[model samples]
Target chain A: MATITYREAVVRALAEEMDRDSDVIFFGEDVGKAGGVFKVTPGLYERFGPARVRDTPISENAIVGAGVGAAVTGLRPVIELMFADFAAVTLDQIVNQAAKMRYMSGGQIKVPLTIRAAQGGGAGFASQHSQCCETWFMHAPGLKVVVPSNPADVLGLLKSAIRDDNPVVFLEHKVQYTEKGEVPDHTEHVVPLGVANIVRRGDAVTIVATQRMIGVAQQAADELSGEGITCEIIDPRTLVPLDMATIIRSVQKTGHLVTVEEAVHAGGWGSEVATRVTDEAIWSLEGPVVRVTLGAGIIPFSEPLEHHLIPHKARVIAAVKRTLAV
Target chain B: MSEPLSAAMRQQMLQRMIEIREIEGRIQELFLENVIRGTTHLCDGQEAVSVGMAAVVDAAHGDTVTCTYRGHGHALALGLTMRSMVAEMMGKVSGCCKGKGGSMHLTDMPNGLIGTFAVVGAGLPVTNGAALTAQTKGTGALALGIFGDGTPNIGAWHEAVNLAAVWKLPSIFLCENNLYGEYSPYADTAPVENVADRACAYGIPGVIVDGQDAEAVYAAVKTAADRARAGDGPTLIEAKTYRYRGHSRTDPAAYRPEGELDAWLQRDPINILAARMIADGQITQAAVDGLKAQAATDAQAAIDWALAQPHPPLDAVHEDIWV
Candidate 1:
């Protein structure tokens, strides 16, 4: 096993994919020369050259539309929008064009494109720059929403995303980029989409989290462990091809459920998960499915206020504890 | 392009234009008969722009064209059979898009009708990506964006054009300036007099052509295609066309001024192309009339075949969502 940071893992995955397939090309604003806005992609241009590794203009529509066009024609383009919030700029391109091209074309065209963008609020860039817009893609039918929490998951899942024959919205929390973890020294380590990871196996309440929330859920689980509360942490790596089986199995085993996410509470991914659990495994539920999510209103510029809005360890712990009270 | 247009090719172009016109007229009749569900934007008067530009597009070379909701003509020009297209409009399983993509979203990937987007300016950026593939892989193939005057004022238009220019990709931007963006007229919506003028901002050559003249369009697109295939850059060609039909389903377009339609009809695309061919002695009036009769016959046969096709299966809707 080798130790690496999440950012390094992403870079390594991209390099390995590009090395494996000449069809895989990467581009975004400042992604080539400047690596990326969050420095997730560095040294790609030097290895791949300008044609494959391009730095595109500040046009999200074009960036995403190009990915769609290239994928349908030939190339497997993995483009980037500096922030997940920029998805709003090209929602029609992503939600309408890229997502539906394959389906709308009656299986004539396949958009094997992967869109990588940093999401979740911790950067203090306020509402415009720092928002976890996972729901937008998860709600989209054709898109595969993959958000990895650790370095190894980042490396493995990204490689799979590039190889998959569908459009994938890979959300990388900028906060996880610097976080270091032990990565398996596998030559072609690929974590397939639609599989949830059982991070912590415990009989207490099952806490389902992803991206930065996985770490926060871990912290809560650790703190709750001292009080004899064993929490089973399930990271739903992908949202669209959601592994409801894993979550339901965990719910059946533990008889309790709580979801923690970085998005706002209403119409969130958590809400969907909660409804599915209720629909599928209501008898197994010991209490109501508690959703620890971001507060209402736009995320503020103030760090303290933003901190309050984000679902931290305390909120998750309270949510997990609330399931026990029932 | 070295030699003048052959008599056979000119005859074929006129035939295809007539075929498109017949299909469009058939669709309007079907809509009125309540056989077609939802709205359809017909390209009744803009056939020359599609057929002429399509004359230079070698679909076998991996060339693809993306167009707007008014795409029945574009799809036909790009080689989608009338059967598949009409079936799609009628929501049949044997459609070009298997009934999922109706009149607005006809797609035939093999023949290079990439997609017909309902949203304005959506195809331009996606088409650029196809050009990007050609550039990256050194494929001589190109992509074309067939949009209306409405797209220029939209956000994706600027984003798509600027990026194409910067990359110098092999893409053709064909603007069918039909003097209207949905309900709004060009004078009321766009500031510029000509849609081609928008291309100057991107530092690309924007040429304006008589949309009613097929030869003018064919010549303009040929030059642009040569430049694109040679790895020079993209070109914006605006075809000053008119749509005889309204924007969408069941509108008479009363907004047009008195005699505007009449003036446009005086320079009807089919009439213009037929007149040129007659003047050059390539085609006779009797031949043109015969071609028109054949087009109507073909449209009827296509519609009959489409009507016989079954509706998409219930489970089929869930299929193709992933692959």
Candidate 2:
């Protein structure tokens, strides 16, 4: 095992994949000589050279559109968008072109493309930048959405994403890039796309969270454990092809659920989880499913206000309590 | 100017143009008879641009082409079988895309026709990527992008051209300046008279050709393709063409001015090519008439074959949603 930060884990996974497959190429704004905006691709440009690791112009649509084209032509392109919010600029390319090409083309083509972007609110980048929009992609068919919480998951899941035959939207929380964890040293260690991880096993209530919210859920579980309220934390590593079996199994044991995320409450990934649990495991629930998320409003620029909008450990604990009361 | 094409090649080009016209005519009849559903963007008068460009690109050598919604001509030019294309338009299981990609989304990957995008200008960046693949893999291939005048105004067009130039990728951007973006005329939409003029901003060679003249288009694309294959970078070629039919099956195209349609109709690509062939003694009028009859028969056979095929199975709808 090797101790590494989330950013280092990303670079390791990309480097390993590129080493393994000659068809694999990486590109984005500043991803070449500058090594990416967050330095997630530190030495890739020098290692792979300009042919494979390229620096692209500030064109989100072209970045994703070209990736789709390259993927169709048998090249595995991993494109970086710098920020998930810019997905709006290239929505037609991502949601329409990249996501629908295989299905629309009657399976004549396989878009083995991975679009990586930094998402979520903790960095205080504000309204335009600080948003977890995985739900937008989760709602889109033909797309696999993944958001990893730790360095280990990042390494394993990223490798699987690059090898998968479909297009994957890999969301990395900007706040968690510096978070460190133990990652396996083996190159063959790969986490499949649809599996969920049970971080804490308890019987009181089930708390499902993703990305930065996973840490908050873990912290909340620890605090609740001191109060004699045991909580189970489930990190649904992938949103699409969701590991509903795990979440349902946990809810069956706990008899309550609280879903947390960094996106706004309405039409959020949490809402989908809450509905799925209530739809399939209502008989096993002892109380109504509670969702811990930012209220319906844009992320503000003020540091305190931004902090309030993002779901923290306190809000998760409050949601766990509310679920217990129900 | 003397024609750069041989007699046999000229006859072949004329035959291909006739085939496209006949196929589109059959589609129109089918639509009227309620046999085909959904809207179609027919390339009635833009056959020269598609056939001329396709004549030069060697698909077997890894050359690829991407086109916009009005892409049936390009599809046929790029060697997509008539049966598969017609089956797709009819939503049959035997379609090239297995009925999933209807008329506007025809794709024949094995023949190097990457895809026909429904969105305007969506093919530009994709073609750029295909060129990048050819360059990186040392495939000695090039990618061609066929779009309308409206596409050059989009941001992707600019980005794609700039990227291709910077990378010195083997790509050719062919703009079919049909003088209209749906209902809006080119003059009303773009500030520049010629779309090729915009290519100067990217430091690439830009050429304008008579869209109705197949020989002219063939020569221009040949030069550009040669430059690309030699690693001389990308080129932008604007074929000043016209679309005889409406933007879609439903449009009346009443927005066109008086005599504009008449003036363009006089310079029809099929007629121009036929006249040249006869004047040059390459092919007699009787031979040209025989070719036209053959094309009509072939188009009818495709339509009949597609009609005989069954719809895709219910479970097939769920299939192909992934790899």
Off by over 4 Å in 2: none
The models' CA-based lDDT, in order, is 0.91, 0.91
> What is the C-alpha local distance difference test score of candidate 1?
0.91
For residues A1-326, what per-residue lDDT tens digits would candidate 1 score against the true structure?
Answer: 99999999999999999999999999999999999878888999999999999999999999999999999998999999889998999999999998888888888989999999998787788989888898998878999999999999999999999999999999999888889998888759999999999999999898999999998999999999999999999999988789999999999999999999898889988898899999999999988789998857688999999988898999998998888892
Highest-scoring model, DockQ:
1
lDDT of 1 at A137: 89
Residue A8, model 1, lDDT: 98
Q: Please write out the lDDT profile of model 2 over residues B114-209, one tens digit for every residue.
A: 899899888889898888889889898999999999998898888889989998989999999999999999999998889999988999999999
lDDT of 1 by residue, B74-142 (tens): 889878899989898899999988999898888888788889899989999999999999999998998
Instruction: For candidate 2, state the interface root-mean-square deviation in angstroms to 1 decimal.
Output: 0.9
How good is the docking of model 2, by CAPRI class? medium
Q: Give me the displacement of residue B105 in model 1, in angstroms.
A: 0.4
What's the C-alpha lDDT at position B160 in model 2?
89
Chain B TM-score of predicted candidate 2 relative to the true chain B: 0.98
Every model's DockQ: 0.89, 0.79
